[model samples]
Target: MLVIRGLGSQYGRISVLRSVNLVIGRHQLIALVGANGAGKTTLLRTISGVQKASSGQIEFDGKDITQLRADKRVKIGICHAPEGRHVFGPLSVEDNLHLGAYSRADKAEIAADLERNYAMFPVLKQKARLPAGTLSGGQQQMLAIARALMGRPRLLLLDEPSMGLAPLLVEEIFNAVTELRKRKITILLVEQNANAALAIADQAYVMETGEIVLSGSGKELLGNERVREAYLGI
Candidate 1:
């Protein structure tokens, strides 16, 4: 469903992504795991078109989107729930969710999807009228994911969905991600929690210093000796 080839991006004069190549088949969950400075988030940003590519090409369903505007990308079914759980602080939780569907004109389907998200994250329904900033960190994370789902994304780009949450909440978030997989929501998850991410992914890639170092099925990478020593700490 998506293809990236020799992709490169930079911040000012410094390079962040170097010749990164990846592919995601429709309805498959793909995970990209690496250390803090490995440029995973930058890669997601570039693919989502929030950051411009310095070189290479990105194609979605065979059309080149490397030069498309970010909103245009949304119209083409690329929705990103970026890292940091960025929710509008003053907006009601429901409003934040509604904003996700801003690019669509289908009110009936949008309403249906809203209910679906509420069913997925019950707390968001409970706090429908509350300010997003008042929610707990885990609650805010759930809000972010649910908001993204409101866009009815074909390929969801989730960045650090479990960052800073408690262990139980982390488990909860991962379980929700698994639910997305079951729903056939194509995901390219950029996660620091290598174990959980790789375990749930159908296919996974190891990124190092802005480039893909290894690619394999999730189970294969999980048991890989080098992966265990470096990322898994086992």
Candidate 2:
């Protein structure tokens, strides 16, 4: 559903992504794994239109979206859950979720999506009136995912969804991501936890120092000698 060709980006004068080429099929779960500063986040931000690409093309559903603004990208069904779970601290959980649907004009559809999010994340429903900051890290992560779902995204960009949580909570978050896959939500997951991410991904790419060095079926990547030695710690 998305294609990126010869993608390059730089922050000021420092290049972060170099000639990155990637293709994601509809309803596919693709994981991008690498060490810190590998430019995974930069790639996602560029695709989501938050960061401009220095060169190359971004195509979504056969149309070029390289020049589209972030909000315009959202209207075209691309939603990003950034590295930090940046939920509004002071806003109630429901309000925060509601903000995600701001691009839509149909109240009934928005309400239906709200109900669907509540069903997927019952905890968010229970804490609907509570401030988002009051939730635990895991809960906050769930809220972040649920908030993004509120936008009814066709392709979801997840950046480090399990970053700071405990092991059990991390498992919970991964389980939720697995459920998203079952629901046929196309995902471009950028994660540091290579093992868990690869386990759940249909396809995986390994990046290092701003370039894609490896790409394969997730199971193949999990067993790769170089991948095991470098990222999996096997």
Candidate 3:
């Protein structure tokens, strides 16, 4: 449903992504795994229109959207849950979630989606009136994902969803992501945790130094010698 071709981006004189090409099929979970400085986040940011690409094409569902603004991308069903769960600290959990649906005009649909998000993340329902900043790290991450869902995204971009949580919380987050896939939400997951990311991905890509170095079925890449040594820690 999403296609990126010959994508290149630079920060001033320093190029971060070079001719990056990728395609995500409808309702598929595609994982992008790489170490620090591998341009994974940069690629997502560029796709979401938060960062400008020096050259390349970004097409979503057959529409060329490389020049679209970030908010416009969100309206087009591209919701990004950034690395840091940037929730509004002072806002109530319910309020934070409501903000996510700001792009929509239907108040009734927004309210219904809010209920669905609460059902998806029960913890959010329990903390509906509490300030977002008062929640635990794991809860905050849940809130972030829940908030994104409030936007009714067709293509979700998740950057390091398991970053600072405990192992159990990481498992919970991954499980939630897997559930989202079952619901047919197309996902582009950028993660440093290769094992977890690949475990649930339909397809996986390994990147190095701003370029795709490996692409394969998740199981195929998981068993690869180089991937085993570098990412799987086998």
Tens digit of lDDT per residue, candidate 1, span 133-207?
999999999999998888889999999999999999999999899999999989999999999999889999999
Clashing pairs in 1: none
Q: Tens digit of lDDT per residue, candidate 3, span 1-234?
A: 999999999999999999999999999999999889999999999988999999989999999999999999999999988889999999999999989998999999999989888887899999999999999999999999988888999999999999989999998899899999999999999988998898889999998999999999898898899998998899
Q: What is the lDDT of residue 212 in candidate 1?
A: 99
Q: Candidate 2: worst 10 consecutive residues by lDDT?
A: 113-122
Superposed Cα deviation of residue 227, candidate 3 (Å): 0.8
Error of 2 at 22 (Å): 0.4
lDDT of all predictions, in order shown?
A: 0.94, 0.93, 0.93
Best by lDDT: 1
Which should have the higher TM-score, number 1 or number 3?
1
* Cα TM-score per model: 0.99, 0.98, 0.98
Give the alpha carbon lDDT tens digit for every residue of 1-234 in model 2.
999999999999999999999999999999999999999999999999999999999999999999999999998999999888999989999999999988989899899989988887789999999999999888888888888887889999999999999999888889889989999999999999999999988999999999999999999999999999999999
For model 3 the TM-score comes to 0.98
Q: How accurate is candidate 2 locally (lDDT)?
A: 0.93
Error of 2 at 205 (Å): 0.5
TM-score of 1: 0.99
